[model samples]
Target: MPTDIAFLAIAEAQQLYHWLPAALELARRPDVRVSILSPSDQILALVESYDPTGSLRRVRLRRPPSRPDSLFRQPSRLATLLLNYPTIARFPTLVTTEISSAWLRRVPGFRSRLILIKHGAGDREGGYKKRHRDFDLTLVAGEKDRRRMIDRGLCTAETVAVGGYPKFDLKADRQRFFPDDKPVLLYNPHFDPALSSWINHGPAMLAALESLTDWNVIIAPHTKLAIKAPPIVSSAPHIRVDMGSRHSIDMSYTMSADVYLGDVSSQVYEFLIQPRPCIFLNLDHRDASGDAFAHWKLGQVIERADALPQALARANDLQPGFVAAQEAAMQQSIDLSPVPASQRQADLILNFAKKGV
Candidate 1:
């Protein structure tokens, strides 16, 4: 029997990258029926961008009904889910990147199997929430997360599979953002209020990056922060500040950039894909020995924004020193497979649904 599967792109557009590839991979199969659901046209359009070959069909889910500005600032995601509950309840298996979907279980007579795909491979404590156990099946991008989950008693080795990063399945279009061919530095920060380098250092960091006359800088933070981020005007022509454009989420900056500058964002893993120069900001002077700060070992760590220039100056020279470690980390974290990650992940999901084990 063909398993009815739906991939939820109902979250932020940035998260859609994590699950859509696997959904597209499953679309090519005759035994698995796949549907892509989203409330944002931006998300739907992004889905089509990835499927230029026209392999998957999309359903534009309706957002909550309009209300006055005084009543509703923006529609809640949960409202969208509740409004579409009747339609969402029809699928036997639902694959999503957000854990907030656990709300589906509280609905009366809802029996759909829920699967969580890791969106960002980060070490923040928020990554291992207790609600994670609510899912019937969980798919992770790497062994690093699997080990963390098990160590936290969230799952056993048998409960999770070492599925590779699905975002890697995205083909890069490589948009050239700058006119001169100077090396590009992508300064991506996480949105987590507690761990984000942006909440405290964002404005000043912008000032620091704006002053860089030698290197081209791309200020692309996490999509969640983009929701209410203040407008930033850059004086330098080479300093391109992208709060959250489609290019920010579509691997454009990751592929185009030559160096990575960040604090605690998992996009660093994506940046490390090419093993270029990397510099991490520890401006607040956090303990380096802590598990949350473990990934800082991948590159040079600076204590202040003014140090950014010096760090970038020596990034390439110090890059070769860290390349071997970066390669080893990526090897242990992401499962590099002969078969594409999306195919492996989709096969695991469909097989899990079919066996009902």
Candidate 2:
């Protein structure tokens, strides 16, 4: 019998780009039936757009009950997702990540082959470490990244390196950069306090950018950046703030930008893939410890908000060595060989299902 597979993502609809590449590839398999389990209407729409003929099945999760204290919201939502797994488990194979997958595996009926795909582009410290024994297979982005996962004992050496970021495969359009005449600056802040700019001196950083009227600023903050109302932000005319959008994962914004700025978000790795100048907010003020991709060098690590002007100057300066180093690290972080990454990932999932290995 042909293998049936399911793709699951708990991320919001606008944030679905991170998983699209893997989902798209799995959808193309002639021997594998693909279904996407996501809650966001936007993600459902995106899945349909990519598979107009209904090649991929989609299951939209019901919204979890809300509580008075927002912190309790996580456990509630997680419980809600866990309840949906038995229904999802009817498929013979499951490809998922984050807490949803972790919980789904606990269901006794979900004995089918499970492939856990890591989401971040580079190895970063302080992410959830799942025992490889729980997953039938692990999917990583590149060899170095795969090694990073192995070194942490997070997964067995069986993890395969699949060279694509599913979200990056979205069609790119230059029109998103308009008014296209000005140089675009992408401000992407990291989420964690241990390695992010917003946790320490976000206001000062925002103030620095407020003065820059001549440049075009596009703020693509990490999805978790603003948890509360008003989003703990100060706005300025020059900056176009994206809280989150239906078109979030397109990545054309990163490619269209002249310079990328932020702390330790994976957007840096994604932006560097294009060889653009970057300004790293050295807010962590220490070396990366746990994440394997720490060896990657960032261009112009600025230690303070006062250094914004200088960082911008350095980005505009276009240092050859800096650009080259970043490019090399990007290549090492994600394989950009001749093979189309999406197809490679699709093949891995399909083969795993066939062999049941």
Candidate 3:
């Protein structure tokens, strides 16, 4: 009998990058038949570009209709899974990077094992929710997440595995987005209106950066932010505004930037892979003593827009103070394993399929 496995790429095209590396790794197994389900044509094109030979099976699910009352009113992830139940049910295991995949357990006669591979390694409160415990097995980035989930009674230690982030294996090309060699500042804000700095201080923050000639600023907000509204742009030679472009998710800005500025975005952990200067915007003025705000300890936190200019000016001087803390946080957030993360995840999936939890 053949062993079947499926990888679900049900969200934005950018999210595909998070699972592509691991999917390819699993496809290489002789006994494993890998299938990819995506609703976005752009995501399909990306997968084709990555694997021209069509080594892995690709299924194009229908995109959700824009109108609320349309037949596919629900989001594409849940809708696609329901529509393709017959084909999806054939597989013994289904893998996804989205938390919403937990809903798969609700489908009647759906006995497939759900494995969740989280997209980021941030310390946000959303990562510790009860929904995460619904999956049969969740692959996390490091010990911090595993410990947090177990301590909160979300899941048992055996149910959660400590595999490094798979996206790290997918390398980004060194494309110069800036004109000059000036230090690059990547301003990556989260999409949440409550925790994000974009809602209240984004415009003023961009205007302030335009006045500074010392840094080349790149305003690359979270991809979901562009889906709702237009991003703030500037004509200034030193600043560039990008709203959910291919470059935004390709890790280009994270790798090229000298400094990081954001609020509640997991990409900050990606940038901290090298322990660079970081500045976090606290729009709600929340106390930093809690565990949810642990990431704030990695950088200088500025609560007001007026103080941003001075913070940016003195970033270099303040960076040294946070270096030790950033390094410690980086270790706790990600597990830099000797083996590739994709290979490790593929092995875990195969092992889990053979021995049910």
Candidate 4:
């Protein structure tokens, strides 16, 4: 028998946690048969770790036997796209966390309805791609994205659902990186060259943290940065540096940190879940008036590493002035309720599947 709905888990592991909860929720209902499809053994293994009871059935897609790389293009992803066309054709409705999967809509005989559940709730312009319109339905973390989708004509009110962050539904072990209870600062930076503070201000940022005797620091950059860059190391007893590890992607650092410090990574929103002190870096000196950096208003915004001492001194005290705004922004950025986000997403997916579009 054909699967009623299949989740295409073809992206990086960081993105996997975002959509897995909804798939597991769908599997609980007897009327719906849900399966997870992927070409990556690593992704499949991670999926199994979450669905240990074998609730989310797995199907492995094919990969090219061998392919040469050139300066402009790597064929691995494109090859996977071509090789998996037949498998993608079998499902009635397909749900994925990746926007690139929309490329499959161009296939000659493809008939499955495409549904997208965005992985991140960041405010970067990259999140609003033209390709998003290709999907039949979209699920976003908050009303912030839903409004942008409608404003950009990427999706309509009916086609998009305000699904809260499904990744929040996932629970990971909390870890303590520091021996003492000094305030912990999580310094996470984005990988984007145009926006990242690490490219130009990283070493200086680390130096600023080392100068602080009153704080414990976790210098965890975005997971994508560790992909091509060398591992960042810190020898300071109070400072811990993680380039990319399971702890980085699993919310270990975000949950453990007391003060949030970063440039423009979306992880700031994740850190804001508890409404703690947040400090944003504007090292590149970009214009701050844009909506892309709206979260910056929730806390102090500094332009250089030299300002760290003064900013850290005031971050917590300033929270009362910003807490109300932070809470308001959280409501704008995520939809929360008595019903779990996973179930809400599953309800939408199942209803879409029932339509036989």
Candidate 5:
């Protein structure tokens, strides 16, 4: 009997990268029937690139033709899911990287198991919530998340599994995005208006980077930040402002950049895989003593845009001092087992399907 497994890639194109590795890994199993449900053709095409032989089935979900605002799209998408519930319910296991899928549990007569593969390993407060506990099974990045979720009374150890960060399994080339050989600085800001540096300091930071001719800058904010605001323009040849480009999510910048600059985005963790120099924007004036700002311990924290140039110049010298802290943060944020994360995720899903939690 074929085990029906559905992987929901129902977010923007950028989100596809988060779920792609594990989906491709599971699709290789002969005993599993894997399907991808997405709204974007671009995402579907990207998925096909991994499974070129068409082994994985693709399900197209309908979106409003007008591209209504997200406030309206959520309900519309939910309606589409409900309309297609008959088909979705057929699958015994429904895996998704999106938290919204927790709503599926409320659907009448829908018995499919909901598994959540977290998209990123960031210290953002949103990671631990009541909705997380709703999932039948959640694949976390490491022991840190497991403990946090369990301690917060969000979920139990029985329902949560640690499988590391699946996105780390994705491989990308490190060709510098810029023409010159100058050190590359990736300034990645989160989408949250409250904590993001982009809302207030982004333009100033870009201007500051433009003044510093010694470094090539890549201004890649979270996809949602771009959606909320207009494109950031730059006249400098060394500065590349990329808003949700395919390369932004594919780890190209993370791999190529020599220095990481960000405010509350988990991409910092991805860049820290090699333990490079990092500069964190302290936009919220967060106290270093608090647990929420623990990520700041891995980098030099700057509160003013005027201080960035000096920070950039000294990043290389300052990086070595933080290597130990970066490694500790990486261990807490990601679980790198001897076995590949994708394979571990595949085995966990298969075992869950064989025996329910």
Candidate 6:
């Protein structure tokens, strides 16, 4: 018998690099039935970008016809919990990411056989899993994350390392998007306050990078960072801002950049897989106390925006040590073996679903 499995996301985060590829790989299977939930048109647009035919059945939260700006007022939003409560309550197995963990805990009699996929680079600041070890399996990118999850007690010692983001499955090839004439700089800022752009002067940090010459810059900040205001793309002819839309699963820009600049965003780890130079901006100059990705020891930290020009110069002058360190960390956090990562993760999800049947 085929088990009825539903994959839920709080919003359309599946379009970006971390979650979407895994979801896409899983959705390709005939046995697995996947669904998504999005309360807004923006999210719906992202969903359509993936499954445009409306072939992918998505669950809509029951809500009053009035479009409530607040999630609390949306009847459709309310319907999600009311609807999922029963499905989750009776389903033999449930898999979700941390974004929906709080809701899952509230579901009546529905907290067994759960899987929590570690989404970001773990850290004490990102509220690294202090509670709710109810998950039977925790999908981690690599050993470093596994150690932090275990050390922080985010999950039990039984958690398994499934390798890095299924998105990296595309990195095995060497297709160039642009002519290899100029070096490309990918600015991947983190969304967390303690680990990223929210606390530091975000707009200023970006403006400073605008002055650089010769290199092409791609401003690919964290997805959540755009909720406040869409990122404004500005720069000399060499720069391009990816702020027009959020890329929840697309990371080809990050993979192709020659250098990376940002705080604790996990894309740094992903960019590091190619072993390019990465620079950390200590925008506020505050110590990133207990940030797990910061501890990865891959790049340099610039304390002042004025130092950026020199930092870029140094970044270009030096051999790619940061890239090599990122590769090492990638192996430790995800499997560096020759096998395809997306297929590996898809197989694991399918096998888990099969057992429930």
Identify the runs in model 2 with alpha carbons over 4 angstroms from their true place: 67-77, 131-133, 176-180, 228-235, 287-296
Clashes of 4: 0
For model 2 the local lDDT of residue 300 reads 75
TM-score of 2: 0.88
Query: Candidate 2's residue-wise lDDT over 293-318, tens digit each?
Result: 36336677777887887778767576
Clashing pairs in 2: 21-166
lDDT of each: 0.81, 0.66, 0.80, 0.84, 0.80, 0.61
lDDT of 5: 0.80
Q: Write the per-residue lDDT of candidate 5 for residues 16-105, one digit (tens) a residue.
A: 666777778888888888898766666777788778789889987665454642311232456656666776777888888877777788
Task: Write one digit per residue (lDDT tens) for candidate 6, span 1-357.
Answer: 545555545433533345555666677777666555444444545556767556455665333365543321223434555555654455455555654444566566664466666665534356464544656677777777777767767676655556566667643333354454678887777666655653467667666777776777777776666655456657467777764343323566766778888777766766656677778777666755545545337777888776877888888556466556666666776666676666666677667767666
Residues 1-357 of candidate 3: C-alpha lDDT, one tens digit per residue: 546778887767666766888788888888778889866666777788888778789987766664332111225667777776777777788898888777778877788898888778887777777788788898888889888878988779888888888777885755688778988889998877777888667677777778778888999998888755565778999998888667788788899888899988999988887888899888678877877678888888988767877888888998989999988887888898899888988888889987853
Candidate 1 residue lDDT tens string, 164-269: 9888888476678988888898988877776677787777787789888888988888777754456556878889877766788778999999999998888888
Q: How much is 113 displaced in model 5, in angstroms?
A: 0.9
Of candidates 4 and 1, the better by TM-score: 4
Query: In model 4, how large is the Cα lDDT of residue 74?
Result: 25
Candidate 1 Cα outliers beyond 4 Å, as residue runs: 52-54, 66-74
> Which is better, 2 or 4, measured by lDDT?
4
Steric clashes per prediction: 0, 1, 0, 0, 0, 18
**Candidate 3 regions with alpha-carbon error over 4 angstroms:** 67-75
State the lDDT at 311 in candidate 1. 91
Candidate 6 residue 67 C-alpha distance from true site, Å: 6.9
Q: What is the Å distance of residue 88 in model 4 from its true position? A: 1.7
